[model samples]
Target: DTVSYGRIFKADKQTRIASVGIGYADGVPRALSNRLIVKINNKKYHQIGRICMDQLMIEINDENPIAIGDEVILIDPNESKDLTLEDWAKLTNTITDEIICQFTTRLKRIEI
Candidate 1:
């Protein structure tokens, strides 16, 4: 998070929130909220506010680490500081399976 975000949230701009044309919608609990912080090219961004059933918003800083359609990590299981679905489970007070199953048919699997 940075000062630009603090400023932009106050103003609400389409240019400010980093988002995907696609995201979760299948019964995703809003309590996951801003807990999912994605890492891209070594920079971090918090998914803004509550995650909608069909979409989620992420903040991109002036120190942009990604471009449109660039690959990024939603949560890394191997990294020392990686965030996991378990984190979402904790935030939402739910089981890990539910968090993991949130992905829709829209997601393409990558064997990491």
Candidate 2:
């Protein structure tokens, strides 16, 4: 089944999909769509399909105990090296500052 606006994500079997409430409008680059890997409940999942204006989707296993309101780490240094701002910058062919600037005021910044 299709997951997002542009790309087609066809699962071989029944898959659990979770929708994240952040997207390009929230500073997530559309160029990272289908390429970004997000962390949830200490597990990593690949973001699938095209990123919407205010949301994205990730594939999860049926057994994953992810629930609503669980935190999704889009850029976490403690989780994985790939989830760093530097990596995101390289993936989008931009600098880290540009990536940082894209995050709109709508997102709450939590320093850890």
- Candidate 1, position 19, lDDT: 67
**For candidate 2, lDDT tens digit of each residue in 1-112?**
6678855777778888999999999999999988999988888899988889999999888577999999998888775477999999999999999999999999986787
User: What's the lDDT for all of these models?
Assistant: 0.63, 0.88
TM-score of each prediction: 0.69, 0.90
Model 1 CA deviation exceeding 4 Å by range: 1-15, 26-28
The 10 consecutive residues of candidate 1 with the worst lDDT sum are 2-11
Q: What's model 2's TM-score?
A: 0.90
Q: Which digits, one per residue and each the tens of the lDDT, describe model 1 over residues 9-51?
A: 3424444666644455654456655666777777777776556
RMSD of each: 5.2, 1.7
Model 2, position 32: C-alpha lDDT score:
93
| lDDT winner | 2
